[model samples]
Target: MKTALALLVGSVMLAGAADAQEKTIRVSYETPPAHIKSRTIEFFKEELEKTSDGYFKVELYPSAQLLGPSEEVAATARGQIEMSAPYFSYIAPVEPLMNIYQAPLVFDSYEQLWKFLETDEAKALAARLESRNLMPTGYWFENPTRLWGKEPLRTLADVQGKKIRTVPSEILQKAVEAMGAQPTAIPGTELYLALQQGVADGAFTAPNYGLTMKYYEVTEAVTKLDLFLGGYLVLFNKRWYDALPEDRQQQLMDAVAASRAFNEENVQKDLAKVDDDLRAVGQQVIELTPEALAEFRDALAPLYGTLDPQIQAMIEQVRGL
Candidate 1:
């Protein structure tokens, strides 16, 4: 009888072990799987599952399968979703300080951007995000936004009188106006048609956007303005994260670090390919000289003063980096 009891006890323990390895975590984002944002999450999923020894499963819902871009952060915060990668601009309205990313010429390279993100200033910003019930773990540098148009935007004067499609933000709109261009907020779905039909003269966005959405089909020139390094933030529900065991938490952070590195490397490589692909298709790729970029930067200087003081300080810190 004692031997029979031991066998039953061992069977129950084995079942519990099997159940423990079946944990599931769901992640969502608005971008297509081909985009870096979604690809980064894929890396995160891989690292997490490997690090946890198959104990964690990450289900990626790309292309807004679970939630739209604007709805991601709120949904994560409410614990309706385990994780989400949402555009930084979408969070700017709720947290005005986050607008530092939109300040033109603030971050010229991915290295500079990452250096600033590792600083205390970024920690405070992360804390602010945590206050909203979401924990920001990593940042995905989506792409370097540039000015592309029917004609090359070679000089500060080139932007004058041209209507450009931009993400509708007060700061961005003001920046566009300051550069002597009108900022038109057009949906991504309509951007290609807008440019093709002459509704807008050009658009300011990532180069991949032109490639993916086939904006290159209509636009003839692209200037590497290196205006702003747009990013998507990886967020987890704070309450959920806090509920994890200490070991589990450490494993998650480690996985996040690995995933971030993977993303940074891949994004850099992809950008180079995108440039080549754009050029291969007969698009005029304009590599801006230092002098020309300086002229454009100087013309947009007034925008620095328009930002909130804290945001301005953050920009200064990044510039110093």
Candidate 2:
């Protein structure tokens, strides 16, 4: 009986040691503290720890502390980090089809963008991540894209001969050039300095981003263009994810879904407050007339034809939904 008791105690001690050896995952994102993206990640970290009963822990590195926007996807893929939240445009170089999410005027509302993510085509795109040894656990919506400039951009002609900073997406670059602007690929972190120094005269970004990034301080005008909706992929290192127990895997997936919902709610709230915030900061907000809106959309139409066929098919499938 003493031998049996000793054996049982040894077993328990070994199990405890194994459990203690499970490492905490590190997740990275480029969003600053005031951004909803950072808030959503905080929510995930809290909920995941509670749900896992301390068996799983998440270490969040925000504001490019661990990896910059352009490097997040590659870092996650290489397992340098366990996970990252990267804007689709940043990952398009690895997954060119991701550029579809940046296609101007494709999604009229956040609801439509979420619906497309659950579609078959989106799932197929998610599958492509396996090749890079990465997994897209889910996606979060950023606010609708808006134009910020020193001068009013009421029509395509207004943008002619101007330098515009855009995320590194071929579609956006082509669209800006088509509108007669010199398109410059600039990282988000450097945009404010670029604008203030006259390296670029304008930028395309969400209202909340413009406000949080202090774009209003550099530019005098914010145009309500609503040209595109920004989407971010919450990716995980496949090897790390696959090694987790089945129950832990399910918990992570549930956490992702919950975090995404939280992010969506926050974005809606922030966007509602953007105009007032921009106005308070002395930025003029302009609404385009219907004719000007049509002209802006027409200028980007050629992009629809030039996008990858796979992306075009995905767009069609999403529209059908």
Candidate 3:
């Protein structure tokens, strides 16, 4: 009888081991196939597998293969996917304070943005992720925001009367309206068709995105407005992370930080390539003169008041830094 009991116990133990070994995690993104966002996800996959000795694996789904940007946060929270890299603005509806980073002209350089993100204000914002059952591992940089139009946009006056596609953010819509252009909020996927069909005239985006999305094919001019730093968040499902062993959690965090540094370095290099590619394609590239840039900045000043109080405070902290 004792021998029979031992056999049954051993069988249950083997089944438990098999269940643990079957664990799999999925990471998804909406960026185009060739974009840096895809590259970042690739890095995450490689590093996590290497560090965990193949015990932890990340399967990547790019170009909204699993869910669109609007649905990613909720899907992750519900454990439908293990992770997602979402644009800051798309997550703004869940955490309104996130729009602080989306504020026009708030960050003039990558260094400025990095410094602010390391502060208490940024930590406070990151803590909000816990309430939503998400963990913000780190951020990957998108190129500085700029304009793409069929015709050259040398100054704010040039954008007047043009119907521009923008994200459905109140601040961005207000900024576009204040600059004298009619704002049309559209999803990222629909942008190309909208521009080609004359449903919209032009839109604002990072140079790298333009290259990846083939915006240069439809738009002949690239304007360097550098109005806002496009930011993306790397998030993980809190439940999955919490279930991991302590050492495994540490390994994952270290890998993510290392990957983020690599991603930022690559972005700087790609920015130079984007400039060369735009010039090669016969797209007119225009840099705003100091006087004109200031004028454009002044026109969007009202956006500061439109931000949430927490976001306003975060901006003040960033400025003070």
TM-score of 2: 0.92
Give the TM-scores of the predictions, in the order they appear: 0.86, 0.92, 0.93
- Each model's lDDT comes to 0.81, 0.86, 0.83
Report the Cα lDDT for candidate 1. Answer: 0.81
Candidate 3, residue 98: CA error in Å?
A: 0.4
Q: Which residue pairs clash in candidate 2?
A: none
For residues 1-321, write the lDDT of model 2, one tens digit per residue: 999999999999998876654457798887788887888889989888999898787888887898889998889888898888888898889989888788888887787888888777788888898889898889887788899998777777888899998988888999898888999999888898999999998999888887888888889898888878987888989888887898999999999899988988888888888888889999999989999889988888787888888878877876776
Task: Tell me the tens digit of each residue's lDDT in model 3 across 163-253.
Answer: 9877767778888988999999887777888888888888888888877788778898999888688878888889887887789888888
Error of 1 at 93 (Å): 1.5
lDDT of 1 at 162: 99
Ranking by lDDT: 2, 3, 1
Clash number for every model?
0, 0, 0
> Which candidate, 2 or 3, has the higher TM-score?
3
Regarding lDDT, does 1 or 2 come out ahead? Answer: 2
- Candidate 1 residue-wise lDDT, 253-285, digit = tens: 888888888888888888878778889887888
TM-score of 3: 0.93
The stretch of ten residues in a row with the least summed lDDT in candidate 3 is 18-27
